[model samples]
Target: MFRLAHISDPHLGPLPEATAWQLANKRIFGYVNWRRNRKGVLTTDILDNLITDMQEHAPDHLAVTGDLVNLALPAEIANARRWLTSLGAPEDVSVIPGNHDAYVPNARMKAEEAWRPFMSGDIVHSGSLNFPYLRVRGKIAIIGVNSARATLPLMATGYFRKAQARALSKLLDDCKEEGLFRVVLIHHPPLKHSTHWHKRLIGASRFRKTLRKHGAELVLHGHTHLLTKAATEGPHGPIPVICVPSASQGLGSRSKPPARYNLFEIGGKDGNWQCRLIERGYSTEDKVISELGNQMLSVPNA
Candidate 1:
């Protein structure tokens, strides 16, 4: 049995000090919203809760869906790396970049430098290429892609380069032949919705079609900062799409749920494959313990 922990949008930092850029955003009220609607109850309280919860669960691999830092600032990225290192080594974890991480023009370079201490794989250096990167773990292969790209001030959107999209198709095509469990990690959802078109996954349709053609077991992403569930038609069946809640919002209050994480278990079940989502969160009442619940994913054989 393989247990993978999914957590997103931690936005770790030295607080308002490390992320001055985010502080200057016109949407400053968004942070206020986090304080009121999310885990903004105490100082260092949320991070404390997350660490305790993750340690207790001890998942086989930790997959962070991005937004590790609030502003993609050098200091914020450094702080993000520290938090991630505290969680576990890069070998035990896989991370993708989120829009926030790419907010700076040199976001990619900054991230690579800041996270070098924890990365388990070699950085891809092809000109104009930044994704379809692979992280092989046992029989499961994690395809980490950079969906966060620098955009104009008016845009505030994210996009995958055309080259990256094509590379992704080829990557999946090759992985399909290996019969490995393919898990694509991105910060943006492939399906368009409330997010601006410019901000949405630009090549989502082609991306999904490629997944259907090559076959993938799961797609994990986080950027919406809300809990979401969707299934895309795949060659094998409908693939599960899971969007996890944020790790730190502002305050833990009654109006909103406290910070949370997702725990996924993929393994053999009665000669068939099984994958389940375990919603895990910190219990305010318990304070020291992490709460959990199991929910299975149903993927039909095509």
Candidate 2:
């Protein structure tokens, strides 16, 4: 079996000191929000404990679904790279950016530069990093999709471009032909009405249409900071779209759940693939990381 661990929205913090110039634009709002609210709930200690426990389980690969830093400042981007290294080697981890990673116009480029290693695919696109990149591991084919982009203040929406949709459709078809279990990683939930209007994934309908037309084994996402389960139409059946709470959210969070991560044990072959989803994280009663639940994801011939 190929074991894959999924985590998201760590929002690594302590708010690296930002100069006045750094906070001149969209980051200023994020800075204020982090200071007033996010600072208390999203703690590094919680994230550290969760990662320690996740590493103990020893997944074959780690899939982080973005929002690694709070403000996407230069220092935060660099610090996130260090954190990624601590989790595992770049080859063992696959990451895609989130809305926060592109909080400002130029921050996305900076994040892409710092996180290139973890976000790159085995096949290069003309020596440039592109979305819908393919990374095959054992029987699993991991596809990284970038739905993140800079938006106006108070807007945390993501966009799924037509170009990415076209590329992803082809990748899904190709991977399906190879009989590989395809797992798509995106930062936003693709289902319509999955999130608030201001924070929705633009072009989610197109994204779902692509999946329905081409099909995939699984879809993993983040950005809600809530443990959620939803699905979209697939060729064989409903594609499992799963999301976990923020990796750094501490207990007693007023608005969101505490830190959590998912482990998916995927096995079997083309006509009879089997996948089991294991949810693990902290509970309100204690800080310990433990298994919360386990169940089989709907596969072609489960």
Candidate 3:
């Protein structure tokens, strides 16, 4: 079975010294938020320990669904780069940014340049990176869509626009022809009425329409900071949508969930697939990432 691991919203912390210029814009709010709240709950050591423990399982591919840095500070971004390197090589890891990564205008561009290799498509058809990037490893096809973009203050929403939606639909159709297990990775959960309006995915209906038109074996996201299982319609049937909690959050915070990751075990032929999903996470009591849940996903009828 090919194993895929999913993690999100590291929010790597301890604000790096930022110039007044950097904090003059939207970052000022984020910087204040970090100082007043995040710095206390998001312990660097917790994230470090979680990664070390996750590597022990050795998933075939890793998907990081954004929020790698806090306030998009230069030093924070640099630290996240080193952290990604510590996890695995760029090819072995696939990433999509979160709202926090694009906390301010043009900040997403800086992150893209800094993390080009990790978030890039496997094959550059246009000789430049674009979403939805397709990466095929073994029998699995991993598709990444960038949903991170700057929004007005207190708004943390995502959009899978018409152009990207059309492209994603086509890519899913092509992957179906290849008979690979298709997995779409995004940062926002895309769940209707499940999140605060300010934090919802703006183009979720369109995105869901694309899934219904083209179909996929699975959809995974991580913005909710909760271990959640939801489904939306696909041509074949209902497709599984999985979301995990912040990978580095500690136990003291009541607002944030504990650190965790999801493991997807997939194997089988075109007509029938056997898939098992296991949730592994860390707890303050144990301080280790252990199995929290195991589920056998319904196999699609061919």
* Per-candidate TM-score against the hidden true structure: 0.83, 0.98, 0.96
| Ranked by lDDT, top first | 2, 3, 1
Cα lDDT of all candidates, in order?
A: 0.70, 0.92, 0.86
Poorest lDDT segment (10 consecutive residues) of candidate 2: 123-132
Q: Using lDDT as the measure, name the better of candidate 1 and candidate 2.
A: 2
Q: Which candidate number would show the highest lDDT if scored against the true structure?
A: 2
Better of 2 and 3 by lDDT: 2
What tens-digit string does per-residue lDDT give for candidate 3 at 34-151?
8887776778887887787678889999999999988887787778888889899999999988999888887788887788889888785544459889999999999999888999
- Number of residue pairs clashing in candidate 1, backbone atoms closer than 3 angstroms, sequence gap of 3 or more or interchain: 9
Query: With candidate 1 superimposed using the best TM-score fit, by how many Å does residue 185's alpha carbon deviate from the native?
Result: 0.5
Q: How does model 2 fare in lDDT?
A: 0.92
What is the clash tally of candidate 3?
Answer: 0
Q: Give per-residue lDDT, candidate 3, residue 109.
A: 82
